[model samples]
Target chain A: MQTGFLKSSPKIILRFTDYNSPFLGPSPTVPTATTASPSSSLQQPQTWICFSCSYSNFASTPKCELCGVKRPDALTSSSSTSLSQTQISPTPILGEHSPTASLGEVTSSPTLQPVVTSEGISCPRCTFSNHPSMVWCELCGMELGTFKIDGMELSDDGNVEKTERAQHVKLAFRNGGSASFNNKLKSAMTDREWEKITEPISVNPQTDFDPVRGGISGIMKNVAQNQEEQKETLDQAFKDLDALMAKASDMVKLAQSIKMKLNKDSSESEVSADDDSTFSTYLLELGMSNPVTKKDSGSIYHQELARQLAEFLSALLHKHKGMMVLTDVYCLFNRARGVALISPDDLYKACSLFERLDLPMRLHQLASGLLVVQAADHNDDVIAKRVLEYIRQKGSLTAIELAAIENASIALVSEQLQMTVSKGLICIDETVEGVRFYENIIINYQWDQQALQ
Target chain B: MSAFDFPSIYNFPPFFTQQPNEATWQTQAQLWISIILSYCRFYKIHRLDLSDALTTELFYNKSINRRLKLETLQSIIKMMIKQGLAEWDPPNKKTSAFIYWKKPEEWATSISNWVSENGLNNSIVTLYEIAHGEASEGTEFHEIDQAVLLKALDVLVKKGEAQTLQATNAEEMGVKFFGTG
Candidate 1:
């Protein structure tokens, strides 16, 4: 592992013994003992010279352990300057009777006094040394405590335990030029907005209502007031409208009955007078028409029809036996009830309603795992055709694909697919590749016909 | 081959990880599964001993220098198992699997119908004949794996529509009949 270039260069080695030791400077102008010191001979020099850094240190040292600059020249040099700066400073002497210095005052003073310790932190800006625990520097008046200090030794194992137990302080700002402790920082947070207020609800004897006495008294007073008012205003208007409605309905029935009688009376007339007679009467009374009918009783039949149709279609899509894609159902319902296009919300409500019915319509996924709806009276042939066609063209499809195609991702596609799969409208085809859909749904297919053939 | 030159992208380790995106991962996993299945099928590899050789042919990724390790191979097989594509022969046989690109049930049904259609019902046929003979020519059953065919036959036998016997100690024989049951 030796470098090729280093082998060609000449090597040098030196050994150190004391402060006056020759190894401190290269090409030492001093003599070496060259032999084992005789025990009775003069004791070796008490101090030593560090050969790597030229610094004076304790003698009888076997190696320069701090600089780690090995004495052997064969060792390649480490590029770092750590080996050249090991200096041992002499202990500083305390000056007695110094001006502006009191023994107790200097030790206890706290305001921005930089005290250097082994765990001292150096300010990057001012180079003022301070203990790591100090928040501000004494020399520069600069804040310095928040930084992370490294390479400092702990006095005891208790320091490690103390640091481990210390909690991080969280500071929060408050409005109106003030700040206070927020207890929530120390407690478990709730998964709710802070502004939500809880009010205490209490049962009070003064506020509770009595139903039996209140019901009878309230209805009696209301009935008396209505009776007195009915003689003059609102009730009379309804009474008059009721009489008019009866007359109008009677006229309609009389007209229908007359038309039926005329048709029955005619034995073999070539062209019955029903068409022109009804038309001419309308022409004669066109300007002088006084058609009297009560306008109040509203039309509920059309509304009931739409509601029934929506309910029926929803049931057809969701019932257990039938399975339809919601999109398909939407299209079919809209087409069948021509000119009556249901809104998306109504379509959704209908699906949920029918899902609640017996044998809920199940949503299913295709072989490509696309979403589809299955109604109770499911037309499997239609589903099989559509799903097969999709898978064939796309190679594969996911629920999102089916949803995009259907244009309604939320209501019809997801629920119906889940339902149909649960009900086995489709079989999940898993390959080493991934799950897919397959049309192995065992409905009443005529396998017997093929077998007989 | 001169130590198989690895593509630089193979050094990009993400290529070995199963992607999280559904479609992307599905396609990637499927492609790897298909490639491995086809390689194993062609090589008649029942067990993959990854330590045996650093053969680049098994994983021919030209653009990436990295190749599938044994663990990654097992993961791909596991993905296939999830899709019902292959099954480990046993829990301990993580390195060996019986691939069912068409599952045993599917194969059984297909074979039974093929037999009934060809009027091979109630007739005995040798295992070799069923796999490579003229009768199975141009069909999915042609050159079928013997162990896979045995499992399919075992399914049919349990259903009472087929029975199996050894025509010789070294030979396999099976008979089937289309039954209403």
Candidate 2:
């Protein structure tokens, strides 16, 4: 676990090189960083207190120059809180430890002011400052600011106390100096599971060290294993598409079979014809992949548009009782065009051109000022008969109600009603509520009776 | 507006408004003319007030919640006058109309027949008796307008079937019908 933490440290001892570099120093910045580690990544001057001389000592001094005794504390004066309480000389001391006695001998102060590094970070455990750019502590090879190492290692081994070396290495790894291959792969899958898992692995040869180089051989083997599975699926899809393409001629054969069966019209064969009708309907929907547009037919735009509209509207007219509002046709036509939308004027021009076209559609203007495209087969008499039938069921009908019955606008219904009234098929009633239509009752009127005898 | 006396077409709301189309309006006008005649005949109402037709029960059709427009009412009345079934009583404002549900000739025949049935031929009878008298009470002419009654009498007098006699008062003018010979 500690070795994992050392993965991100900036520097490594010559002997610990194998344990540290996972990317084989492929990045040029990684090798130079270790050589320049002492001055740039670490190197903060500190002062320590001597136990025998009762004097402040430079942290670099191994022994007190005044009493020839070793400095007892491993940490600096500020770091060891109990160092002053342990013992004092009990007398005024002099020698290299006393500033007054050696003012000239020392020549210059060895203590450096604590630097306010605007860009670099100070190591939290050792308190030795480190460059913020460096991900690990250069002095102890500790992972700098490694939160995951603390969480993952502490969670794993709560009872086992970490050794100094293990703790230092653990700090480096958790700070994200160089993540393990398994950890990187695990995190990569967190986003898009399918794509990230299949994506080729990228390596930064500098900080990642030997693992990038060492892990390549292992990764290739895993990829080869996955390649076999993907190859089978592609081959299966290709086989299915090829099979469907081969059977295209078979669809026409089935249609021909139904045409033959339709002639027989037996009660048993009617079921087969119904099935064929559904299949034919599906085939019809597939027929209109290529639509005529201005780019396709140029100056013949209105003429071709009119022809195409006739085919589309004939079906729509059958659905809407042989007539539909012009505005509704505009919406349906533009929606079918997808991206290339035509204006209302364009649709109107196309519909008007239907006069010359073979299509049996006519633009009719109702007396109430509503425009509609109606099939030629549905004339005024047919509509009047329908209106009469509707009245027969409902007894009497208003313009709005009749509009709903005929799937037309109220204005169109009103105009149709006016025509029906003129034809003597119906009569208009103007009441306090609104206008309504009823059956014509007056049949004859010329007969006058002679006075009673 | 009594249901008993009202025609079925009176319940039809469209009958109140005059149609705009020539063919439709012609048929509708004829229908209105017939309804007005039958309605007047049933109620024995000889005079029709044009302004009152809009607000009064005759034209204020409650079932349809509509009223005949004054112009449409006048036009229909004019049609009746052209057909000789009605006449403008005062001829100036044309405000009031005298509806002849029966033409003068028709009334003359009806009254002449009444005189023969009652053995009153060649006998003197006051004009008031022929109109408001008890004998005429069972007929449509009972309480008929004086002008219409004089017109009916003039039709008989011109045919020489009745002769007018001098009366002491205008209301008591008398008529004598000749016996069949």
Candidate 3:
């Protein structure tokens, strides 16, 4: 019986101890069993023994009533020795007697009789007995499997308070089983406290929390810190870019100094003239010191851009033989400007302003609608005379041959040749050998006498 | 005649290709007109077939390997026709044209002069005898194309200086000339 109580006590303790209540009922057998030693119990002062069943009886009874056998002194002596042995182990004694003591108290006391039920679980919240198979109270709807200590007070006061909130139920066993149950329950509570103390220590370091860092506030703080770090990295990248730009400007200045020195020494050196001119042109193309930008020039952007463009292209136009296609100029101008690149529309508008601004380099549109930048000195009349001179010198000249001689593109040369043809200074022969230009002889031919012959 | 002397411009490559500019092309057209008239007169070529002319040395320059395109030659011929220097031979078809180095009026004056000089005024003369007879040999009108001779006679008839006697056969046609009254 003691072994059975020990086995069953733990299950009841585990279930009931979920509620942390200070009012866990005390063990009724603990005080008495501890104080009354086994030697004192061996005296067997007031109780009479039943030999057949080894049952303890009241002092008034002499027979072994459980089996109807007569009580003998030898059997009484042997039973007393066994009782003393059982009393030496206090848990077994408590387990053996506590159930019978609770049962006697249940029968003798009228107060507890209404609270105790014969079958099924009783809800402490309403004292409603639910069916054994039901997990919740049928009347109060309190959970039946677990006891809630909060409901125990209402039951103890015997005052039923009805509220809209769901009520928790406390369990109270009436068969003295609660004494051993409370003992096991107290031991489980201590074990839970031990776990609670060691839980933080066992957590992984990444999640381990100090008093200042634990919940949503901590995560928000970390996000803010990460944003600060990102801003700093972005600022560092911009600083590096600024430093690179400064170094680039310094290099440009050095190249300009070298070009100045080469120009000063150019008259004495013959071999370096070509190299020096090209190098100076390269330096000139590196980047303009102050390129006209929309931000800087604002409303007069195109006008200022036109002036700057004329200044920039004047030298280049001479190098390219006084003409360049508009697209090629756009590329070269943007390359020299470096950072402030202009769109095609902007370049066109700026070139259009060349006539209004009276710049040396004007935008020239060919018969085919192809736009070109030509030096102001390189007009149709001058180009016609140049072509006429070449044709007169060579007797006849194709566009390709002139392009090779002039070191200009065939398209530009051909356009010049056509302009000359339009001016009546030169004529073209389009044959299987391609278009060839010749001096205008028909204009000077004496028609009257020539026709008469 | 001594081999016809070609103008220096004839050897020019651009002369073989038509010009594109308006003023330049007009000048080029005049040059071509003079060249064509002189060339036909030198060769005594009364009619020019455009396709056959394209391959001839008159239109193609073998030394320079440049040939005047057909469309350009046609345009030149059209220009000449506008000036009465040339006429489409079959009239409606443009494939061939008659080049008048000496126009019918000029040929009529030359024939009237020849008749008066021969003292044959008011005398009927067969058109074939004027064109192919030994007496008319070495004359400018001698061996002239029959069609051109008839055109020259028609000019004289319009001037009231000559009258044509038409026969059933075209070869036997005759004309009587009168001294210009």
User: Which is the winner by lDDT between candidate 2 and candidate 3?
Assistant: 3
Q: What is candidate 2's lDDT per residue for A1-453, written digit by digit as tens?
A: 123222333332321333224423223333332343333213323333444555555444567767878865433332222112111111112111332333333222334222337666566556678654443465775544311111111111111111112322333456654658547644743443433322232222211221211245436645886898899889997897767645644654554556555555644565666766665554433333345678888999999889888887787788778888899888776655543567888789899888788579988877766789999888999988988889878878998998887887676678788888877777777766788787765433342423311
- Candidate order, lDDT descending: 3, 2, 1
Best-matching candidate per TM-score: 3
Q: How well is each residue in A360-411 modelled by candidate 1, as lDDT tens digits?
A: 3544555555445555446555544555555456644555665576554444
My TM-score estimates for the predictions, one after another, are: 0.26, 0.49, 0.59
Task: Tell me the tens digit of each residue's lDDT in model 3 across A6-119.
Answer: 344544343233212421222222233334333333222344444346565443344755776666554344333333333222232333343345334323243322232458
Candidate 1 interface RMSD (Å): 17.0
- Give the per-residue lDDT digits (tens) of candidate 1, residues B89-178: 665777567777567788789888878777787777777777778988876777787778888888888888887766664345745455
Two-chain DockQ for each candidate model: 0.01, 0.18, 0.40
- Docking class for model 2 is incorrect
Q: Which has the greatest DockQ? A: 3
Off by over 4 Å in 2: A1-295, A367-369, A442-453, B1-4, B19-28, B54-57, B60-66, B113-126, B134-140, B160-169, B172-181
* Model 3 chain B poorest ten-residue lDDT run: B1-10
Q: Candidate 1: misplaced stretches above 4 Å?
A: A1-453, B1-14, B17-27, B37-58, B62-64, B167-170, B179-181
Which digits, one per residue and each the tens of the lDDT, describe model 2 over residues B140-174? 78888888889999999999999999888867998
lDDT of 2 at A247: 61
